[model samples]
Target: MRLCVPRAGDPATATAPVAVEVAAHLLGLVGDPATATVAWDIDWQGPLSVPLTDEHAVQAACGIMHVHGRAAGRPAPLAVDYASTVAGVLAAQGVCAALLARAGGADVTRVRTSVGQAALLALAQYLAAATADGDDPEGCPPSRADAGQELVPAACSFVSADGVCFELEALDAERWLDFWRLLGVDRADTGRGWRSFQQRFATATCALPPVLSATVRRASFTAVRSAADRAGATVLPVRQDPLPPTVTPPWTLTPFPEPGGTTIDRDGTAAAPLEGLRVVESARRVQGPLAGHVLRLLGADVVRIEPPGGDPMRGVPPMAGTTSARFSALNAGKAVTEIDFTTDAGRRAVRDLVSEADVFLHNWAPGKAVRLGLDADDLRAARPGLVYAWASGWGDALGPEPPVGTDYLVQAHSGLAAAVRPADEPPAPSLMTLTDVLGGLVCAQGVLAALLTRLHTGRGARVDSSLFSAAVLVPRGPGRPAATGRPLHTRDGYIALGPRARQRPERLAPALGLAASASADAIASRARTRPTAHWLPRLAAAGVAVTPVCTSLADLARDPRFAPALTVGEYAAPLAPWEFS
Candidate 1:
């Protein structure tokens, strides 16, 4: 099996240069770089690097805030190239997994993923439900707040008197009273309900850091963190320094020499490398389900087992009638089975499923696997050659793990929140669940490598990835150049201009009826004089990267390049990024 990709300099292609570089890195992992090929598509450009055809348009119109409830019209701070890089990484992982299967004697040929899919995948957790409609009425809370923003009463950063910042999350409704008691707030002054209490707290903390700072100043950071942990709350010191780039590779492959368990033969199987493979996915939330989703796209048979009430996400917001658009999007290509894990029968059924599966994946809280008898050793005992993958908040190497490892918490601990914050503002996490998405991709990569090893040694291996580790792997540096082409207002709508225009200022000047030496402000002023219709064709003819800002998925659906990617029926959906040739 040979992996062929377009070369970086292919004259006819506009694939992202970064995407090509990432693809090369993945191919290097397989130890056979000579077999890969690269081609160029003339229509491709940097903007095309984003998987979705018109994502920039969407962000521009929506204002892309990380925390909900901000005024919609506020323009987002200058954007960075997050979605494309993540898309590149995930695409590489999918291809590598398929190639591994082929190396293990499966007759697989190709694998693919798009930048749009990567962007959606990263936001899976947040997008699974609508803001006001689902099981969680409050919607996804802000992971952290900017200095002057309204802090989420339950989960936010509070500074100590010593000027040290600590993140605290105590979101359980039933525990509000308990939390008040723990904080030594008098019960007599406690408000009537959760809402009232929230209001009171909000009023008291109107001064931002000073209010929370004064409250926690009575105790040391260590004491506060310890108490928060003891009360089933999550607390961590806010890491201020940017984390150095990952010193260790994102995925690790280990080979076992011992012979054991059942072996799968790929002979006469369908062309997809994983066509005959069976996967038992006992995971919930973004990380595990996403890993399963990727494998399913590559033609593996994935059975997602949920507890009796179904995965909690089934009831998340932004529903399309009775179905959760978020849940359906991530889980569209797989089979689902509900088993009551609390019963002995359910446990046995899961064990039986594992015995026949090529992979077993889960992201249960730490120690829960051991309690449920679903640890790597127990599952491997049932199917000696089974690939077991564990996704968590933090890996075992981070001794004495915290009680919680959600994506937001991991962001705070891993320095991601601080890195993205403007120098003058309080820390704000990425608007998307960046860590969860990356962790899922890394999990798939590890499982694929283990599968390859299993084919050779007939012994399975354990693969681990954590949100913390994934966050660490994301590259951070000086921000990319701002979209020099600003969005220009016209009679009808706004049009994106700049990037391509910057490259050919001579051509852009004539299209916008401006002098070649015109400043950006001058060009913008000129563009506003005409309606979008008058300028779109003229600018486009000159090869300026321009398009109307898309306000919704429907807007993107109208584009020929994006129409095929839309999954329309009872509910509208975006198809997974990858495609097999």
Candidate 2:
């Protein structure tokens, strides 16, 4: 692949290639970079510019630091690279899809993605849901008042008596009672439902953690893990290690006669390659939904299959009316249906759906799909040429049969927590769900590749992505130097100064009223002498990449250009990072 490096002095130009590199690595084409090319000179900031006030910048920076609630007072840098990286991956996927389609006899060329677009997609669910104005507001859960309560009660970190921190995730509602029983909690006596259990533990303050920690300390990690497995719960010990990102070729390819279904029609429009493709999604949470969302943006007809009551995420916080802004952001532009897959009729209905689908995607824990008679083999049997995909938290090689794959647990296992930890501080997670977002991107990439291969071989393939692998793919190393340019405090707000400022201190110092010989701390002190408005123009005139940090999605939506990206119907949603031409 030939890289079109942006002109010197533009940091934003470097973002698009991150996705290409990732895709090339996955395709085993990194060694032959000349095979692909990028148009990197695209003006990214023009469509994404938003006004940034110093006060808003500081508040946004603080919002990122306090994402975990537990780290509210801590000084932590936002993982600013995440948005661009994810956008790059999405861009790469689009390119790959277009290339494959062209090779498969479709007329198409030139796929593009931007950091701004990627940032929007990465936070789509949150952004859409938060800005949505619904008539009937969903009631907040009782646990909402508790600062420590996570959305899923069972999927949080717990400390052991020995102070070892681990994560537990019991996603299967049926296994809820069993999990508590294994933890030695008797539901018969306590009469606690899942929500109540989460509420009690989350709000227990000093009471719950100690009891659980003491109890967990009595057993070895292996023993606890084994017990969890027997109870159908996923438990994993948090570790501090580096996990480099890597991708293997597709794992399973089964040849069978084509189902003779109609291929997705392009309608003579080369702009959307995957248009007319029908996707049946039986996935929950961010990973599968995000993947489906990407496919939808590529012009697929995505039909999401939710359980009888609807997706659990529909009830997650920051709701509008009866709708979850998070849910709307992820499921927008797709058809949705409620299905009770546990029933015989539900199974048959899904089987019929699969027969007509080009893709069948899910994130059901291992064995759950099989138990429900909806495993890859079953679905592929229904549609012989179906591109079957599964997203999980861990790869199959992990010792535990099915490890807990929640965002936090995957972050811990994949070494992200260790890598991003500030000196002398415990491991800190990125403010966003990095692994899930990346995993979704990887999953989409794999699915697109599988589709391309199917065009050639006339057969279906199984594509898999896990949070562990996604975590590994993230580039990690020593953080930027403390003295390196960073978000600087202004008398009334904050502004991000790029490292270019540090490299050109002669030009930057005067802009901030600092001497060229000033120390990093001295520069920051000088910056605080003026308000943001006074310095923003000077920094821009000097050709430094600077902006007021966005305090919230709402803040970003206020800008007209950004408003279009975030607004969807009555709700604000993230814009897809890629534009097909």
Candidate 3:
């Protein structure tokens, strides 16, 4: 792919990841490079361009087509102010991309539509804010402009007319086009005479001409609008809810001085941002363990305290020589020890660990945690400065919902399963453990944020996260149910439709499907004819919903974008040991 290197004095100068402190913030739905698929397998170890694989290109193309389709619905000489419209679109796309990346979608069509709608929503909110703010709101704060600027509280909000709302003023079209180019969207119109000439010869996949992608997206939305108008329907505009205010942070951040006693190893890693901080991990399974992993990533020394039987996730599928890849993905790169917190001795061990620990992460049942003396009060009584992190299946600790949860169980419980299946077919839980991974990522962010808070305040606080809550948080959906019910699928279900409308019910049915009927069976039969790879692109063209079935962990490993998970279970150490100092 081609790249359009910014001029020497460009505002978004590339910097080390730590320089961009909230690098993870830039990575998700909130940032400009609003992406759909994360290219999870991409070698995240190095720079952006060298690893420009096919998956990255496909993902980028998908995002461009989606934006274009949305723009096609709009009228030409679009009344949208250039900067504001594009900014709105970028904001929406950022959230959509983050969702899509965190939870892989079923079909390409939904991916595109969801992304476009999300982009529109984000854009709408931004413009509404800008219009409310009387036009220019300090011309898009520097942090919003730069990919590398540290994203602290001061940088999170823009000065709005009413007060300080956590929204930005909108951007006009020309500036929007520039933003698109910076994000690597492809387009034919560069608008600048010789400037167009300059980027014409560049690689199409590397970096899109900002103006080009914007124009293309505008055209696509115009077409979509025209089609709707011809069908005798007025297009309804999309809107988004206000983002949650940063409250009750999960963890705190503490910048560390260079190590004086320990030997330094800075060859390829980011600076040890939390070199002297200590994190005590009591979490089992992915969500809580992953929080500790994130702390370790930022240079904190993480001490993982596993129960005697080890984490239950160790028994999860896709194991290698009896070890679970699922467990390894979240638990690697930390020092591990075994403890039994249920016993007084075990509780004492935990207290000793917490006395020197800056953060503590766990996923035990909430009430059980308190009964077992692992509650915030019990632990804090021993160590006041400790940041307690708790991840669970549901949201019982605070607002709505109760404990008793699992990743897949939560997917079925939280209406995520409802969203994934085809409208006509039996509900099928997602092939991937979305709640597990998404919750893990969020828990990690919470832990880090809480850490940052500890840096400012001498006191520590309890930070709680859960799969039930996170599932609701990450996926755009409705509020909690007054009373909970049993999860839908204790077993797997299927979704399929034959090429013809009248396929036999017997042929379409899964060998032993859950909640399958004759009608559902017919749908499944038709579904089988169109393998995931073939159906994804076709459904996108037809505007139908679909979900690609990933049969095995190996299938995912085969995809280059998923390489990080491949060596997850290979935890053996080198034969010869080396010294740190």
**Candidate closest to the true structure, highest TM-score:** 2
Q: Largest lDDT belongs to which candidate?
A: 2
lDDT of 3 by residue, 213-258 (tens): 2333443444433433443322221111212222222222332222
**lDDT (tens digit, per residue) of candidate 2 on 411-477:** 7776676665544445535435667777887788778777766765678877777777677776666
- TM-score versus the correct structure, for each prediction: 0.75, 0.78, 0.43
Task: Choose 2 or 3, whichever is better by TM-score.
Answer: 2
- For candidate 2, give the lDDT: 0.60
Ranking by lDDT: 2, 1, 3
lDDT of 1: 0.58
As for lDDT, the candidate ahead, 2 or 3, is 2
Model 1, 1-581: lDDT tens digits are 23344466653233544454555554466454322532211112222332223334324432222221121231233234455556667656666555555554654455555554555445443333322144432233322234234433332356666667766555564455454456665443222334322322111111122234455777677667666756677776777655633344566555444456535555545655567778899887678888898788666899999888788777654575675666776787688899987788988889999888989998888988888888887877888788888888777536666547876667677777666555654554543466777778778767776776665567888887777767766656543233343456676656655455546666677778777878767876787788878887888776676656543333443445544544555445545556554
Model 3 misses residue 39 by how many Å? 21
lDDT (Cα atoms) of all candidates against the true structure? 0.58, 0.60, 0.38
